[model samples]
Target: MNDLIPLISSSINDTLASLSHFYAEIILAAGFLLVILADLFLSRRFTQLCFLISLSTLLLLGVQSVILLNTKTVFLFGGMLKLDHTSILFKLLFCFSSLLFAIFIRYNSPLQKHVKGTGDLFAILLATLLGMNLLAMSMNLLMVYISIEMVSLGSYLMVSYISADKAQTESAMKYALFGAVCSAIMLYGISLLYGFTGTLNFNDPAFINALKNVSGLSSGVAISLVFIGVAFKLSIAPLHFWAPDVYEGAPTPVTAFLSTAPKIAGFAILIGLLPVFQSEGGQTNTQYFDFNVILAVLATASMLIGNFTAIWQNNVKRMLAYSSIGHTGFMLMALFAFQGSGFQALIFYMAVYIVMNMAAFLIVDEIEEQTGILLIDEYKGMGKSNAMLMTTFVIVLVSLTGLPPTVGFTAKFLVFSSAFEAYRNTDSAVILIMIITAAISTLVSLFYYFKIPLNAFLRNSQIQVMAPGNSPKAYLGLLLAILLLVLIVFPSVIVKLI
Candidate 1:
């Protein structure tokens, strides 16, 4: 009896311990189940039940995150997952952006009228956010692979969610095929890594220590191969072939979500992976510098391609798609500058990026809702009429172009400073080139970014459409944009927390 009592107490304590560390995910997962059930039952009676469920869940998760504010602990079945400051920061961002995304979908999307599976869309988004939260905290290869697939599958489905048109269906098909191929390649790479290192845990001291014995070429290949999966998520240059078509075809809200949240989470995973794979002693046993060189080259290519090609784009969403690729290059700069203190920079940059991109897309959807127009040229002369929308758009675009008095500028400055610090410390030639190229690209971006306002306020067109609507959603986005500017002035609030 005495032995059994001790056993019972220990078991109960262990269960409580596990549950406590997972509060944020617990809130999100519970919300997911509630959303699924709500869609099953209430969606027939109330049109907004699923959206409300998703929003409620996100709100609960945010509250849970605040509750667990400073507690950093690893939880789950074993040492396979972690919830630290870094992971918590990303999770908070994911939840916050998801909240905004839900609003965007609710207000501007044609999904409510056109799509049959919106309930499914919300459920899938919840599940994908779960995957992203896990991806941020994963300490094992198995979790990494699972989380990646979860996000990929969710993305593929979202791309196809409104497949009522040929272009939409074709975009979905391309995204599906491309995503599957990348996952397969990534799986093979993970297998190679597991075989070489004989362990699946990324955070285990033993696993990293064992990696030292592996051949440099083998390690580099394995590491780069693993990043292929992540690169697919971020849509950096080489892996970016599908971005434009998919962005143009998908529901604009999904495009907005895809362009921001999951990509940032993917970069978080890359940061987690890179430190373990860094070669010691500068011995250079491997020919490739793994992700650093690959990402540097990709950033340079992305900057050139994303900028020059965007200059030719007439469609607003498609233009933003390429612009997102360009932003990927800037984010990569943060990755390169990732020495100590760079992690904070990366997190802050991601937060600002989310706010900036979501706000930009919100405006896109708002304009589309009011005027039924989608082209940059269609925006001509509206800057004079849609004063509020255009002013917000201009502020957001200026941030994207990395100008002052916006969070975008601060984020860019943070990353550039980190890169400069890296160069100062190491004098690496690659760092030098990345800095110069990023500086030049920042200038090039102003040309295309200004085109929207230039056409709206400066250029002439017969695009005399109805005035923009007085939407609560648009105002909400504007409020968030204002908060972003506030953060830009006082970045330390977020930076200190990160």
Candidate 2:
């Protein structure tokens, strides 16, 4: 009893001391509460108040995350969470993406015109942001499950919040059911992992040691089950079926948020789990099935499936959804090939990807609003009417295609170069296959991505339309497009930060 008292007291002291490092999350939680209260009590009088609060909260969180970037790595909450450069980097990414989402939601007409207004959406955004933040920093299996569920529930709510039609409701239902199944599988896997290892901390030596001694078949099953949930979140192949439906059905702003922030958080979780396949000497764990090979196959499959499938998509949102899956493939390759400074490459690619995707979606949403066109064929003759917007869209698409003189090119180069380096170092055929698959997928993506421009510029519309005038969304997207060009010229800016 005496020993128990001392241990409990020490834990309390440690948790209290951890509070300082946890201030940003505390602020996010507080902001979420405040937004809820505002929505309840003040929303009638102040239409834009929730949006303001949400944006401010995200901006503040971004600033705090940047400040924390300088701090050395530390474990908090008795090792349930980690504060490190990687976590801080991803937290900042989520913060920036959420901030942009707030802006995107503010200017979205459908969400604004909904009976419930955008206040609830803002609250949901904060909740989702909180989940992503937790997901990035989580260091334990329990934290992993809780954080993923937090993000998933918030996502389900966001999708269903403004269900204006059957499609939206259907998408939400599919997402919930699919996500529930994945979560159940993941929980079962975690249970089996705990049963085998008697520990939930993947970073713990005991966990790896147990895997080393356990039957390869059992460990492989457990790992594959856990990855099923991660793959769903990432929208990788074989589990990517829900992405197109959800992306097409959800509001464009919500889709934008879904494609960027949650995907990045998924990568953060994958990065956290990578150590399980690594040894203290920084070599692959030969005793287990080579996770790199498995990831490489997944990456290759995602790229091939995503890019090839996108070619047949006429709906712009669905195409981008598949493109996102293709990008996931590239990121998985980066993860498989991770070496010293390779993380920098991954972060850089992710940061650029966020900018490019948000900009593309912003343009898509604006075009959809102005012309009520969602299909590629409908984009015909829009170039002459909405020249500036289409031009920006072209630039963003070019970036997405990873063409030169754009940040996307630089980002892709870094990832591919890192993979090549890994191939050279380890002589792994899987790494080489990933590089080839990435190249082929990039080529495949060009066909669909170019369809946007080809239809907009080359074809003539059946009906004439007035030009789209300047709007905040258009300007925001243009600014992002210009930022991409700037990044190409000065790639070091983001590189140095990472």
* Winning candidate number (lDDT): 2
Tens-digit lDDT track for model 1 on 436-478?
A: 8888888988999999989888976664666845687679768
Determine the C-alpha RMSD for candidate 2 after optimal superposition of all C-alphas. Answer: 1.8
Q: Candidate 2, clashing residue pairs?
A: none
Residue 396 in candidate 2, Cα distance off native in Å: 0.2
TM-score of 1: 0.94
Judge candidate 1 against the unseen true structure and give its global Cα lDDT, from 0 to 1: 0.82
lDDT of 2 by residue, 1-498 (tens): 676876998899999989989999999999999999999999999989999898888888988988888789899989999998889999999999998999999999998999988888888888888888999998899999999999999999999988889999999999999999999999998899889999888778888888767777677788888888888899998999999999999999999999999999899998888776433223243445667777788889999999999999999999999999999999887775576647888999999999999999999999889878899988989899989999999999999999987899999998888888788888988778889989999998999999999999999977997856767999999999999999899998888778
Alpha-carbon lDDT, every model:
0.82, 0.89
Q: Which candidate achieves the best TM-score against the true structure? A: 2
